[model samples]
Target chain A: MSTWSMALRQSDYYWTLYRRTWKGSVFSSFLTPLLYVLAMGVLLGGFVEADPSRLEGAPSYLAFVAPGLLAAQTMQTAVFETTYPVLSATKWQRVYFGMNATPLRALDIANAALGFVLLRLVLIAIVFVAVLAPFGVFVSVPAAIGALLVSILVGAAIGMPVYAYAVGVPNESSFSLIFRLGVIPQFLFSGAFFPISNLSPALEWLARLTPLYQGVDLTRMLSLGTWHTGPALVHLAYLLVLLVVFHRVAVRRLAKRLAF
Target chain B: MISARGLRKSFQQKGQEPFEAVRGIDVEVRRGEAFGFLGPNGAGKSSTMRMIAAVSPVSGGSLRILGLDPATDGSQIRGRIGVCPQEDSLDTELTVAENLYVYGRYFGIGRAEVRRRAAAQLEFVQLTERGGAKVEDLSGGMKRRLTIARSMINDPEMVLLDEPTTGLDPQARHVLWDRLFRLKQQGVTLVITTHYMDEAEQLCDRLVVMDKGLIVAEGSPASLIAEYSTREVAEVRFGIGENESSAGAVESAVGRRAERVEVLPDRLLIYAADGEAAVAAVHDAGLQPVATLVRRSSLEDVFLRLTGRTLVD
Candidate 1:
């Protein structure tokens, strides 16, 4: 079968599974980040009001964190969705055995899984953007849509490698380590919650190398309409490179793992 | 057609010896025939099945399915082969009909065609009434039938079933057998493995009895029984004490009447051409047993004779 057909089929399969079995988790997954934005930006920032810097132009703190939160939430959801679920379908539940028994190849299954993650990222981003509109965070409708697409691409770029790692390893400990050493570090040091310029030079260099930093930087640029061509190109290049490299790895690993 | 020559597979264990699961065996399955691999657990039946299914790589051998090398044309070969794995791997999140519909899509079937096939397959498995029910709510038998129906979504040329009736009740097993029989009648080649001697006797046109990664015997059920065991068997039991040492006496007493004598912990089995005459002779010899039964030889006898152990062991 053609790759597109297989990918579309697998995406539908995952969507059906998620809608029926994971409906309860979807609301909480999309709601938690919105609450975080409101509590951290409006509630917390109101009590600690300080003179607004020039970089922090017209929008309030809530608007500033809104796009970054959307990107971060998408990354979080996409990474977990692709990694554990992919591993479980292969090793734990062994659902791919049935799928691969048909015309679907391993690469088809991988693409389908990635497609599903992308779709979920977009859905979550739309919810985040809709919630932010009431808080006066959404600047331009077109820019908000562009930011949402960028969030999905960035999340997928980061998640595909983790998906590859999850399928290759035989146990769950490696995923735990990735969450502890990889994801936690990215979440804390990637300038999602605070400005990176205030950090030490060594920390900034480390943060700049992370996928989350590039993603948040791009989101911040889109949200503030402060799109400098050079930084935008650099962030786009980083995400593109990651997407190509990790997608190749995921396809190869899945082929070796699922196909004989 | 499926063919394999010098097929071998070995698994390396950490800090211990490497276990050879399949050891240089040859096999061929022709079109429109019911072939079976009959063996006890850990006899490499599953390893062989996996190799044939093209989901597990061959360590040192040549294998082909439908005139294609699994290593190169795995997807193409799999496209025409249905596989019912030992475990029921149905998507528990989906409804009965949705499970079939989505699995058909995996074969690149169109949505309209998948819907039509799903309906027909669900009806074939007698699950049409409960098509909308979630998978987790189905009984084990229903789940197994659904898995079988899911495998046929592509209308494959061959169907591979690994221990299809391993954990089903008698009625459920019979229902599955009936469905498989109908498929065989429609000229679909079937490959199956099971430890149940009765299942093999009922379904297999030809079978290989495997033990410890090797084939010990290969033939039809009737032929294997005729070759390995007598036509009839007699079981004689005495209510001796737990610590009794009368096994030797019983063996000596029935030795002349039967072709062979098997002494168990609680009884003695006498293999003979005519079980009724043998039991009468035992009575004539004044060996008053607590219980006695005469029956025809079964595939279980063939298995025991070849492997030197019970099939369930």
Candidate 2:
């Protein structure tokens, strides 16, 4: 079989196992987005709508923050899917070694991992948008699709590097540090919650240059339908470059870790 | 079939010195035969098995699997070979049937074919009733049999088993041995690495005794015994810690009357073509052994003769 198909077959293993636990993941996949929209969109958007000073460019905070949350949640879902599960397969459960014993190469396993996580990212993004749409955050259908693209792109960018780190960890405890230090800060400060323009100039620039911020800008512009083609291309370029570069790093790291 | 010439495996160390796990050695595994690597732990048995399975690289020597070079044709070689690793690495989250189905997919098998093989294999391993049970719920022997069944999914030409029965009970080991013997009967080339002498004698058509990363002796089990040992052995124990003191008397009594005599801490092993004659000679010399027993020679005697009782690993 070709490497691509072999890799997908590897993912079929994960997908089949996921079927066993997919019911348990209802809270994260469905409830988390529902509550996020209710608390951040309806409740907090009421206060922000009364005060437009905080939300400058948009009509309401719900419209402004929904797509941005879409981007960040995609990142969260992608990283979560790849971390402990990757560790379980590679180290704890040792299924990767079993895969390596077959015709599947390490590269096939790595690529299949990304494919599986992307599939999950798409599903989570769909759930996020489905909930956000009922909350009246998505303005147009094309804009929602644009936001979905940016979300999966941002997720792929961040997910690849985290997967590399996940496969190398001696245990699972250190993963808490990734969410606390890497993901939580990006969630709060990456223009998803509020405009980066209000932040200190240096911090704002740093945030704007990172991957999630680029995703936030792209998704927010797409959701609001106010994006200029030039800036949209730039943001898309930023996320695309990060995705390509980090995917190479991820494949190499996983291959090195799994090598005999 | 598998062939190796001067196969070596070494692990590189960061700042410290590198360690060679398998020193250069030659080996040939023929089709339709059960070949074994017999040694204690750390004898580089697993390392050699991994290399032959094509999952591990050979550090210094030329090696081939199914007539293909592993360096250039690793994936192709692996496609035709099955490996049952020493560790039970089955997916616990997957049921017994699911584990086999998912593993077969890695070889790019069709879904229907995988299901078919999974069922047939489960029945072959006598785990048909437990197909839907989770791997964690299975016993150690059951897990091992499942592993063996999984290895047969690809219909591999050669099966490499790394201590396949390492942690099994006597009954469990015999069951696995019986299944492996069936595979050998089906004309599948079998390469097994084990530390159990009886297991080696039972399963292997031709075998090599390894010690400290080297092949010390190679032959069929009985041939190894006849060459390195004798037809029978007279084991005489004087008492706890007394064999050392009585070594000289036992040696002189059994001298020339036996092919060789080894004084172990607990007993004296007198190797002779005839154990009864050797016992009479021991009594004729005015030496008294607290306990004496005679038994036919086996692979353990060959190992002791070549590697001595001192553990190399």
Each candidate structure's TM-score, on Cα atoms with residue i matched to residue i, is: 0.91, 0.94
Residue lDDT tens for model 1, A1-260? 57887688776687687777567876786688668877977887566444446334425666666777777887888778877787778877788767776767778888887787787777777777677766766668777777777888778888878887887878777688888887888877787766776679998898888999899889877876767889989999999998889888988888777643
Give each model's whole-structure lDDT: 0.82, 0.86
Best by lDDT: 2
Scored against the true structure, residue B81 in model 1 reaches a CA lDDT of 92
Score residue A187 of candidate 2 by CA lDDT.
93
lDDT of 1 by residue, B119-198 (tens): 99999999999999999899999999999999888899999999998889999999999999999999999999999999
- After superposition, the stretches of candidate 2 with alpha carbons farther than 4 Å from their true spots are A49-56, B280-290, B310-313
What lDDT would candidate 1 get against the real structure? 0.82
- The DockQ of predicted model 2 stands at 0.71
Off by over 4 Å in 1: A18-30, A50-60, A134-142, A168-175, A200-202, B15-17, B238-247, B264-266, B286-289
Per-residue lDDT of candidate 2, residues B199-280 (tens digit): 8999999999998889999999989998999999999989788888887887788778788788887788999988988899
